[model samples]
Target chain A: MSRIAITGIGIITPLGDTLTLNRQALQEGRSGLSSLEIFPTKYASLLPFGEIKITDKELKTRLDVTEPGVTRTTLLALHAFKQAVENCGLSASEIQLSETAFINGTTVGGMCLSDALYQDANFRETGSEYLNSYDLSSVTLYIQQRYGITGICNTFNTACSSSANAIMYGARLIQNGFVKRAIVGGADSLAKFTINGFNSLGILSSAPCRPFDNARSGLNLGEGAAFLVLEKEDNVIDKPVYAYVSGWANSNDAFHPSSLSDDGEGPYLAMQQALQVARISPKEISFINTHGTATENNDEKESIAMQRVFGNVPAFASTKSNIGHTLGAAGAVEAVFCLLNLIHDEVYASLNFDTPIEATGLVPVTEYKHMRVEHVMSNSFGFGGNCSSLIFSKGQKAQ
Target chain B: MFYIHQSSCISHQPTFTGVDLQNLQPSVNNQLPAIEPKYINIPLGQLRRMGRALRMGVGTGITLLEKHKADGILIATSNGGIEDSITFLNQIVDYNEGRLTPTHFVQSTFNAIAGLLGMITHNTGYNATHVHRGLAFENVALDVTMLLRENPGHIYLIGGVDEISVRNYRMEAMAGWYKKEPISNTELYASETEGALPGEGAAMFLVSNNAESATAKLADLKLLHTADENLVANQFAEFVRDREIDLLLSGESGDSRFKRYYTRCEQAVSENTAIARYKHFTGEFQTASALALWFSCWLLQNQTLPEHCIKRSGSKTAFNRIALYNNYQGVQHSFMLVESV
Candidate 1:
């Protein structure tokens, strides 16, 4: 089996853009939650979210996107991806472009553009030319065109598990000898469609979400993008490796369309497979980045899965409690956080974690702790009982 | 090798339970209503939550799961829940993009159907939903094959789904994806036209490492993304010839440009071999070729072909080797070879 290496990482979350900024926020237990003000919506006053402080114009100017009228999601992707591409310092034109696949995961592709057009008929007529730009394929097309990449391009949309699967697919493609390198990640911008959808489910917390806490309500919606440059160990020899995508697995509860199974079998099996693939025991996993949406059911079910897999719980936390759930971007964003933990040799405490669930006595890490973290497992479960787990191990020469 | 234990599809034709290729009836028009399932027995709450796409995905997924009790589920969709997506988008537009309905947002997701299937089957095993344009089904199928080959004790439920929406269809038509003149789907293969009728459906199969009850053993599957027609034809012919294929199920979507590749495939087959086309019945979409896979499994299990599938009436040879050739708009070419157990 071929080993997959993470050579580059980029993130644009509510916490901040750089890994250092994000780590600082994590250590300080700072919550990015604030009254929704980025986009003007009727629910703005009612729903608080982890809205980013940067403006679209600022992001576009910073990213240097030549195309005008791009969707916010695409802009976010470009901003973060450019940083990752530049951070690697590899000449884009020199790489084997045909062998490098672009795998993007997102829940909404340019729906923000459609939202703009739909709300204003005048804007619709004027922006009619941009309609083609709203198609999901346009995002990949833009990225491929900008980066001059001609290899396989795909957009994965499996809800929140979308990007985790993208990461897993990138690793598998390298292992399967289909591609030698890949740009894999996900992006999603806040839209009325997502905001309203959660509200209808009655899972949207008006206040800041307290994941795994007795007073926890639900998740605060957020938006951002994150990407990772993954390559085979042979392709990036002697390079400063970020982290190793050692093991990953995807599973489905097949329990309910919108909720997880009470038994937590889907998540449990996913974790088991990830650990098995890494050839490591549960005790070897030092920390976990949980898919703690702060929902009553999700917190409870995820706790049960943790207990079943580890017997004794490992130090774990939900960044969602701080930055809120970013939907399709959650997996990649959280993966970046996990990689940051491995690099910084630290564990982030779950913000707002006050009490353990009565059913499963799983207590999340409540404060930042300095630890020699070796292996960190991150979980992302989505609607329809889709569950995915990824294990990011500290960088080490391939065995 | 991964073996296909069972397969089912709910399309416009009466082919869900099983149909004879020779007895297939021609579609009167290009537009055919989907054949609704007998879901009166299904719970009301489940029914209420499901839209057309979700119903199609879960219905086929459940059918395959009930037959094989799979440990993993892998689904592929090109534009998952597009109908719901459009509805949600329109809602966002209607409310001046105000309070977005969470119901529509959740339903609008591309993996809505896969998630629903996972919930219904209680399958907490390996689960993934892939979307790769025309190669969506092929990618999912490849993953299933790989999983079955690597893991000794796993059964995978794999399926492909795509739903067409009015807005999407209109947009595609504007993009020159559809022909100006509407042609019946049943006559799609014989039309010699440049475009195929737009259609949507779902196909699911149970793939297992245990080949004890397999209808057909999947030998190999490959995907290529080259636009050079001649090279694609040569690679495809080499693949089939090397495998000693006895049958070919081509994804001739009634497009004139793509027909030449299928013609080359036919020329490569032996005089005693049989050939068939299935896109006429299933319509053209990213994963429509999955339906053709169901046909191959059916042929292997029943040892017969319906007249509607036959292009050239060759002698009935023993059904041992079969190959599936598929492509989308001259890209994402895929080849799959299967043999009787």
Candidate 2:
């Protein structure tokens, strides 16, 4: 079996639209969190968000989507997917081939239009234009149809760890000879549904999130999309490989619906298993991209978990402090950022940090610095105790 | 080969412990009532916060793990936690005044069942949830087959659960997915209805590489999504050409609009081959095929083919090989082959 090589990376995040812009902003310690402007919400002025600074109308015009009922979730997905595929220079025949799989992860999906669907279902005057778009598979179906992909297509909704699982599933497909290439990523758009849902959970912060800070309040909801094109090492021999999807694992806390256990067993197991899969020691992991939802529970539990795995933790940061929690898209978006770290040999700062949690006292990398990063571990923990960790290496390890 | 070690289904039919194929009757009501499993015994505090789908999924998982061991857990759902989602949305619209409850939001994710399974089983090795409409169960099957192929000795728990609510049924009804005139589910296959009777259920299985005391050998699983009926026929031929298919179970949902796809598949098989159908008894949902899989395993284990399921009676001598063809609205087509080990 050939190694899984990530050859293409694309992202439309709160910080920037392209990889270049995002890299520049990250290096400069700039944050994308601010007052929400694109959507109408009661918390617009109270809570800061990592909102993509583009209107859905302009996105549709740019992507040339003439059809209705295409939610912002699908629109953002198309923007990132197009870039990733183009970056790899996949031919039309290659894209139309039956060997290419597309795996998407999303929490918002068409639920962004939940209000419109409600009106349509309640009032009979307006015909339901979004009847087909209400399901989670709507985004995958739209992408499959647009790209004419006939191979395995799936959508995963595991909350925050969704896209991380997608990336792992895509790599598994290629490793098992089920597919030659997989376009794996996730997209989530802010909506009344998520806003109200998170609000009810009492985790939406009024200010920018402080991921590992002692006085951290809560997480700021964000909207964005990221995709990576993974192919077999043999097929991408001449291509510029971004990084290797080295190791991955998923573990559950089984403790609470929304909170991890005090021991951080799930997070610890996921990280340990991922390192085992990569055939490396904890000391080899140069940096850790913590899940760092900035909620009181997540940061402390993750810190304890890291301490258990690595006696002294590596240089770590939570991009969530910069872009807020992207939910389903966080895993893939952070994975892309990890790849950028490997490509540029640098580390980005975790913004809005004053003090570390007293229990763990683990301080994160607070300044951008050029360093040697051979392998990076990204963690994504979601509701219902779904936790996933991924290890991306600077280059392929010997098979 | 993927061997069925244990299986469980919570559906309208009497299939929890073992399938009662003899006393099968067509559902009189359009919405067949879901049977509550008496086997689940979680704590009352945790159980109080659970919904039907979540409870059923976790209960099925616990049952499957009772007599067997699993290294991984995989679950599938077409619409995950729809009841909770609808309730949350309803609260959002109706009571948009105060803070909405977090229970609905917490239970609304598609992987809630898988997460719960992990928690209940505490065997969190590899976990994933596939959420494509009709292909949900099939996707999980593919994953199981692949995993077993990679690591031969390890067992896996695979399940598919989907529940229907009034809101979802109304949405489908508004989309013209139901018959205009009310008709009994028994007349589903023959009636001139435009839609299949909507239904819901949860089914789980413990599959392993070991065949000792196994129910059946999962020979192969295939899925196709194409507009051409000829391509489907060709693929179906390729799947069963070498094997002696003793019985063929077709997803003949009572929708006239897509019944021709089943007919095309039937034409691809031999004339003397025995044919069977099961949608009338199970109702229609995304993971209804999981129930069909359970029924097929029951047949293979007992070495009997129920008469009511037989559409065209060939020489049903001794059940050795069986095949299942499932499709939803002429899309998300799949075939599963099972053989006596």
Over the stretch A238-329, how does candidate 2's per-residue lDDT look in tens digits? 67888999999887777777888998998999999999878899999999999999998999999999999999999999999889999989
Name the lDDT of candidate 1.
0.78
Q: What is the lDDT of residue B51 in candidate 2?
A: 78
| Candidate 2 DockQ vs. native | 0.59
Best by lDDT: 2
Please state the CAPRI-style docking class of candidate 2. medium
Q: Kindly give the number of clashing pairs for every candidate.
A: 21, 1
Q: Residue A237 in model 2: shift from native, Å?
A: 3.4
Minimal lDDT window, size 10, model 2 chain A: A118-127
Interface RMSD of each: 3.5, 1.9
TM-score of each: 0.88, 0.97
